[model samples]
Target chain A: MGEEKGNVKWQMNQKCATIGFHANPGSKAVKTRVSLFVTCIVDQVFPQVGIAMTQVLERLGYPVDFPAAQTCCGQPAFNSGYPEEAGIVARHFLNTFRDSEYIVVPSGSCASMIVHHYTDIFANEQKTLEQARSIAPRVWEFSRFLIEVAGVEDVGASFDGVVTYHDSCHSLREMHIKEGPRRLLSKVQGLTLREMEPAEECCGFGGTFSVKFPEVSGGMARTKIESILKTEAGTVVSVDSSCLMQIQGAIDRARLPIRTMHLAEVLAGR
Target chain B: MTGQPSETINQTLGDARLQLAIYSATNRLMTHRAGAVRADLLPDYQELRTEANQLKKHTIEHLDHYLELFEKNVIAHGGKVVYCSDSQEVADFVLGLAKERGAHLIVKSKSMTTEEIHFNERLEKHGLEAVETDLGEYILQLAHQRPYHIVAPALHLTRYDVAEIFSKNLGVENEVVIEKQTKIARAALREKFLHADIGVTGANFLVADSGAVVVVENEGNARLTTSAPKIHITVAGIEKLIPRAQDLGVFLTLLGRSATGQPLTVYTSFLSGPRRNGEIDGPDEFYVVLLDNGRTKLLADPEKRQSLYCIRCGACLNHCPVYRKIGGHNYPWVYSGPIGAIITPQFHGVLKDPWLPFASSLCGACAEVCPVKIEIPKLLLKLRSEVTDAQRRQGVGGVERLAFGIWAWVMTHPRIYLMLARIGGIFLPLLPKVGPLGKWASQREVPKLAKTSFHQWWKAREVPK
Candidate 1:
């Protein structure tokens, strides 16, 4: 299919983007064993993102495994102020990924919760605290893992569309994953990446914040949608699924033509 | 003190005019602040912030010693210092002084502390006229309204609103022009400032070593209020103390830039004491009422005490999205916005409005712009935990606790989590819109679940040799 004006390529690309491909990294040697912690949202809602992420990892010469026992990162409970419940679930997450050398997640929100908040979640419990501390350094968001650990910038994938990136609050502010996705996206051929104004502002899908303060959340989401529309980008992409879901919901509700794609899904394209 | 924050927020959101007013005002302030910081105008901005943070930390850590030293210096400088345990004591002290001196017709400058103490109302109850001299405060006084913004008290009021207020109250022809309204207020307050028995103001910073009450403003009314009256009274929170006069340099540098984007306010008066020997045009008696008023409770907790480091710059409020949406009146106290989110709960206890802490999106914009570098987001999170813990202790939030408990159980058990996801995928579309979920769905569509889970797809694949 040609880079532009091909519905068949888009459909074929979507289907081929499924997981379970073991592709060889032609030029680079295989380096590390990374376990994929497919966040609950990606596992249940956007499975294509996980598939694309795994495909991209395989292309980067990293052996990625799915830890079946892994479940939610307990961020919802933690952020909602139920630390005891959050701690219970965090302990389970820690146990599931205990033996892995590195834990990589496609979602920056869950990844940040694990890396930044686990110590606080497990604080006062000595055993879990130690476990959390040990696991914290090994956790990496998808883009950060690709750039920082796998050391691959250009994933040899190209897309033909204008896209603007949203900085998911947790990843941008907490994990400091600002330029990682942009640097990687810049390498994709035929992709005209237009930077959105006030790109660092929250998309207002702050977990339960959307439901709790729907008016404010909806207003903020509308603001973001307007910003994305102003860029005239066909697709709005981010590393976190939660933010995408919020922004996408607003776009869909408004009946705007913009598509919300995960950075993983976009980067894994051929 | 006000209606439920949720209801008020809803009302504020419903009003398009108020939303635009708040959004534009805050946006302008935030843009100006950003430009001031980015221009590299304040050569040692970051360094000054660090020093200011350290100084506030040191003062708060040793608040008692500084308070004593502050009182001694004020006394040495011929100013009387009265330590008030609460707002009642503050009101009583002011009333007693007024009664002893047979003073009436009080003129005042913009002071949030006086608002906190309800100083004017207390005097008014005794049949004394307490007139506000600062233009914003005077406008609010004439309208019989509370401050809407911390720095710009009447920011929510448009020029048209002010014109209407002056027409109705001041009995002047309705003047739509902004400068005319200012002139009208100046003419009205000029008489009050000249004839008033006492002039009251809030200290921006109380220099402990020098016993100086530093008042920063643009209107020049605070200076006039202190200078024109026979007796000058300064009401300030005990938390407002700094160790030395040199500390003012660091604070003054940040206070203006973060507040109104000014290099320095038009007036920065350092009133050390009452009119000195042979001094012209100053008060005979100067009194500083150091108010505790639940500040000690905040200072008692080391984890939350950093909230006291706030310099009342309102930079956090201008930058906070939640504040931008809800406006200032929704906050339960005089202080609103990000600072209010932390301090309101800390000062008043979280139980009064458990939802205030959760009102924020946990955006760190407040922390980024804080002149004194208070970790506002962290404090907010800390306050959230406190609210939840309070609920737990009181046997409240049972439904929420149970729901979270079940959620935690399902999330930990992958088998159940997957089953629930599948079942939710099937039924979530069918569930009737109701309650919080209904509210969420009203504005935004819920994410549709995938037909197949990622793990299921991964497991079905054949291993490649």
Candidate 2:
């Protein structure tokens, strides 16, 4: 509510500022095709997550396009401060999904990379910067698309388990996605939503940070794993695969019975 | 800071007691802050942050004008203003003043500016006795440690640690009781306040309109530290200026809550100058030392000048996960956590303190809790790029650049990327646990690649287009 005074515009254009996150369901075309930018991690390491996301989107009566040319959102490079490398990769991403009606990303961080970091990457290039901004408003994280864009609370999906939702940082802060995801989870049949104390806390899979500052990152993961254990939830669900990757790694190492699932995979359940 | 961030992090992780102390202290502070700044308690908190941000930004943008106005007002009120380019000059000025006045003993309140310049050590080296009056600072001064946390300088210590330090330094009983330790420090410092010839403090807000150095503190020690001595010296950063006295309402509301979760600190002193004629109490001579120390370089950069907007609230340190893991001694500067991460590199130049910005996970917690609404994560990211650029100039990071370059090439070519993915699905599970992968595998198991990738499955299945 407090805007900048004295015309200097000190806003400085925060990269994570919500560009076009709000959904007006009635004003948008329902038949407009949606493209899935399955993040590199999801595409290679955890493909079932991508499959699950595709199943849910197509079931909702929207044609989902897989832009084969889309390799990555360049988050790994961007977060590691290799922005020039990120720009090279990000420019390709902008081109691949150029004409797509609705670009939906399964991972929160990847979607954030497109909506936020892409503008920064193309800042010096006027033409590409315009393209990046034009495409940013249309990009949506998977769960947000299901709730806000599709206006569907229950996707007629069911999963039997006590699962806590991990609010991945990019989706929570960048996409302003909090209760929207919880609201969707609550509607899932047979799913008992057990909330963890540190649900909003990071699992410490900060791209290269997991390796660069592994001890600190691992320490955070251990703390998060304990929080999940305290909840006594059978399964952990999150919007991003990257967070699950970190949690899953720790859960496996600790030999804990806790299984990590993508929110889409849970929603895609029978 | 005892060592490099990684080195200290490794060392601290092994010390379970120290880790627990840091966690408990920071956790308690976080709980207090959350309750203090809730919407019901402070309804206009967000707007106040914006107003403070705007006010600070305007003042700093026209800092030359405000500095002139502030200096004029201070002089009119019979105070002397000396601008110091660096810590060396600040130390030189204090030493000169002490020698001229024949002041042997000097008492100080909690002043991070003084800590930054190592003022006490500098004075002590020159055979002048400078005693820290704040309980936390006093404990640190005795233990021969630097200020660890912003609000709680001895935050990493426990009652037992305090007992040990007190027993070793002050020859007191090994008192494990909290109140007893406070009394022990209090008893020792009260004598210094009376006998001290000079008192020093750091200003919270330097009001340009009236030239009042506003200090907000919970301890009544600042009142004694500034008033007990005949000479009161205030060492503050040049960026601490605000345009008007009326603007204190906006900052005062946020400062206490953000710093220590108090509605307002116990004492909020607004001192302009020396005592007027017929005044019963106040300093005979007042001096305000405005220290630059690389602040002008930060101010010159339009994108990152908001680092100056920090009010040293310590909210960022309390909420930062990285800070919570590694603790304060890991940060190699007077400031720690998000503020330290950004400022340390900018002040010392990236070449010297290159590791700080990369210390964060870019979690955005610091920015969320900031009283002045400084975009800390963004600044960290910006500094990271600067560090990387500096590294590149030094001909380092060639391998990393080449790896990213190859990654970019492979990523742009869809066929090669997918082809590599198919091959990765087979061999990824067997990847040797070494380097980054080994570091990641230290605590967490490496993930096995999915049997059939989503891309391959999508192409195999012919859905209605």
Candidate 3:
């Protein structure tokens, strides 16, 4: 009974459209700004995806805020069997975003690290687990937040090219973000979506796995590159940047005629 | 790749022909499985998978009780049951019986358990002639290699390779045609099957209610192996039991579809005991050697015990991209692919094959295709922790720990991290490819950092409008 009561209070603190997450946000008007949790890869390597995401949200009539104190979600350490190291960084993430009403991330893997594995990272500490659980329901991957929570699609974006979708593993399986991203792509004015067979397979950029077993990783990526080429699309888009880096690297090595872009980058285009 | 240890990943990746053979074979199997179990074709498939998982969970949870019941029933049905703890014990028992009965030849069907124990090598070392009856296993035996894949043992071999192997081993003319080659293998093994003194096989499922061993195969070799010889012996892991005979329906329905996408295999034999008064075709003595080598250890760990629910369908192998990329022999054990990744480390210890758990990208394909609902990625993660923590305890991987420690320290401090990022953005392109970045660039180009980061752009453009 006591745990139930405590959960209800945390649920009320959720500031999204809510729906089934907490209390209904049906009639609520947004006064609080949406904070962006730009992943470490995006902040350093691919800032275009982050900017495009911010632009799309601002066009949706929601104010955006960038929390500068954020460094990373600690996924690389967490996935590579260094949980204590991941814990120290994940704790800082919890503190940095503790006061935000709504938080949105541009990458699926980072968002999953928070929503799915936070409990595991904080398993031994009850106090830290509570903090992790409270911020979990509030964290949303980019494509999912647009369709499911915000109840908006077709953010008036336009791109002139044929593109195929690459389903990053974490977003497709863990977050269940299928078709929603495609639905957003379909609304783009000049974008023609070509579906690739076996697009849901991994591109083999498994953090340290790429370096640890470079030969096998390269083999897996070559197969993925072949599948992408069969689509004959000018570009391949996905919800995560890590897979794009791997795919892009292989494409560059083979001197293939194609491009890889994050979904947020496609949406941010005018 | 300095800090990581490997057995044979580099060698496997260089063989493009072997990679294509594995990829196309697994792709064909995947297509067949998907079509056979489509939601429109089999509406109750999901429900059946759930039921099968429940049955396995219950049986494994009470394995001690169920194994006792099975042993008593086997005794009642005129068969004997023996429990062997390791491969040495198993070889000793088989060899002692062979010596007592004056047996000179042993014929085998396709039993991976025996392969796990290197049964043929031990027997031949003592000058006993043991022959493989399955066509795939026979070809592999001639080639002197382990299984390339679980279900399709010789899938990596082209017909040309087989022709060469057959010609060299049997001293026959080269036969590239598969049918003629199969005939050649059959002609060679027929004499052994008819005159061999004992038969050894593996059980797909063991029914406690009937005390029967169920062996499913597309070929008729297992049937002949069990009936053609006077003594029939089954070498099965202790984790292969089900509580009731009725549960066979669910597993039988799943096993063929998951393995080769057939409604059922060509032969589904339920062997209970020795020959009866009127049954002239059955074996005179039946023995089931239950193997426990390291299974009890898996049964004790609640966190990863779900690996025991595997029925060896090989569906996970067919769907695993990593296994397809690297082939099977690099796994350093008899079992290969996703099942081998989790099972080998547990059975053989992490210190021996530390790279097994870290071989995957955790893409969820193996778990998605697993008929028994084994959470492979989660178990792999757990095994990764075990391996890393073990290495850390022994102070063997100090460099890796220090690197991760520095990564965490930099990741927690935003100001220092931003300064480093700024420095990296300006000078990273001029820096030579070395360390981890150099390693990543070996196959692909390194990613270029943006001149202006997202945080920087957002900070400059936020006008409070």
Candidate 4:
């Protein structure tokens, strides 16, 4: 429909985004095979993130598969307390990635969608819940997988700018994936990391929360951007591209000099 | 009865300016607390909460025995413990102690127990200067106001507001930066901490096994307040005492992590008594004032006794949606949120805050995050029932009583309720957007219904079977 409207393209494009972090096939011993379940968001607005991910993954010596039919992980609907809508989304995701060796997601929100929301999403149906639980153990966020699972810290990329990381709420609190993005970021040859105080705070872009309670969401996001500005960093980097888009949108609206980037893009040295 | 609380929870609900103040501040705090706890690498977090609850419950159940043991231990360590039955008694005890010691300046850390007793004004009345040493408390002191948040007392003020207050009181100039403003406040409070004749503090926990008063703070003012002065007084509610010294670790782990979301607070001191001969920076006299002040009444009710187990970690306040929407002052008491909703009615009596218990959406989020496992929602429901029952007895010619009486009657009869619901379903849409019901409906939309009643529809559908 548009650059960022529907679910299907967003999921497809999110899968394409992870191609940027793939390992080189011939040069690597660890042989990290990853399936990119492009989250519903990247598949829609920023299909380029998916394309960039594919190119980055190939450059890093890994072959990434795009599970095209994936819709969503059911977190948005589930967290909103609508389990039935979430169930439809969860089964769609499971059927797409149930057989895959490893499922890596681009967003911590989506990753939490797989890890935590799946079981609850299918809680009523025993058979589906069992299958959902089976698929959950293998799901990992891209940054977490790149560092912890793939054993690749330096993606041999170079970027010359000052960037600070925003610890997304779900990834930082729920998944406990604090150091993964940092470990990958530390190896960016020309990049300088300026740590922001109270970086772990939510940007308050709680999905429908932005539209539903726009004032509260915008107010919280404004507070987050100010904290980013206080660090005097040229760029704000995060593993989840959605939070990046949110803070970046506010920054652009304010016409501040600061920029936002995905951890994968930074790691791929774009 | 003294200071006017918010008119109604409904009045304060969904006020955007207040929401901006509450949500932004609480979300930041929740994030900080989450980060600190994550850094600890504690695998058994759920287990830790369970252990904390169990320990608190056990300690509170045998509070008298533990208090006696704690008293004996304090005495053995050359410190004194005075048990007070009420707020007046506690104030009298502290005043008597201050008079006996010939104290002039009393540098006090943030103590909610002391606040509960209105000790600052009492001490000031007795010609003793009680200067608040905590940064947030210092800001409130300068502004001549009560605390808005438990952890961050000056949370309601913007930096500009603080600068204005400082300029007026300290005469440093108004347009100062945040750091510069803090620097001025620090410089002023540091002198008070050093020269104060008597220091007072609030204990986070009373380790009964050792008669120690544990204080946790990031500012380091508490350490200075308790140590630098010759006479040190720790005023804590009697419920603070825990049964064993070993259990301190479990509570402390959860307390610091849950309250501020830190791996550990910057400063946590367990003071047993006055400084020994070898110690250089220590107070000569130590006094632990165990204040009752309606706690014994709270302790008597088994259903409500769990309120006493509160470590004052401020976790409930952080997670509460109503508190986040309305701010703390809306609750009509010092303690607000789910915990406050339960305890306020008991302390103020059921007559004062009739609407306080109905404020919540009955979401069980508060009890989920509570470290002490206090069934806050259950207690709030209990309080609500008690308030309603009391109103039914005492509220003569009151519309509230009439409304509730009709509600009780309608709830008892399903057929009458169904008929009334059908009438309401038709007429509610026709009603004008004014008056009390309209205002309530404005905030929340009533769901549209099927033309037929559920019972009628079910009965018709079942006939084919």
Error of 2 at B221 (Å): 0.7
Tens-digit lDDT string for candidate 1 (B1-465): 112556667899888888888988988898888777774576788888899999999999999999999999999989999989988898788889889999988888999988987888987988889998888888888888888788988878889989999999989998999988889988988888878999999999999999999999998999999999889999999889999998888899899989988878999999988988888878999999999999999988987899989889999998887888788888888889989889998888889988888877876778878999998877877787787899899998888889999999998888998888889889988888986678789888878889998978788763543
Mind giving the per-residue lDDT tens digits that candidate 3 earns over B188-280?
999989899999999999899889999998779999999999999999998899999999989999999999999899999999999988877
For candidate 1, the lDDT comes to 0.86
- Please write out the lDDT profile of model 2 over residues B242-299, one tens digit for every residue: 9999999999999888888899999999999999999889999999999999999999
**TM agreement with the true structure for every prediction:** 0.94, 0.95, 0.95, 0.62
The residue pairs that clash in candidate 1, if any, are none
Instruction: State the RMSD for candidate 3.
Output: 4.0
Candidate 4, residues B144-175: lDDT per residue as tens digits? Answer: 88777777777767788788999899888895
The lDDT for every candidate, in the order shown, is 0.86, 0.87, 0.88, 0.73
DockQ of 4: 0.02
Q: Second chain of candidate 3: TM-score?
A: 0.97
Over 4 Å off, model 3: A1-32, B1-8, B463-465
Q: How big is the positional error of residue B374 in model 2, measured in Å on the Cα after superposition?
A: 1.3
- Candidate 3 lDDT over residue span A114-220, tens digit each: 98888988988999999999999889899987886666777888999999999999888778889999999999989999998998889998888898887788888
What is the DockQ for all candidates, taken in turn? 0.45, 0.51, 0.69, 0.02
What is the full ranking by DockQ, best candidate first?
A: 3, 2, 1, 4
Query: Which 10 successive residues of model 4 chain B have the least lDDT summed?
Result: B439-448
Clashes found in each candidate (C-alpha, N, C closer than 3 A): 0, 0, 0, 25
Q: Largest DockQ belongs to which candidate?
A: 3
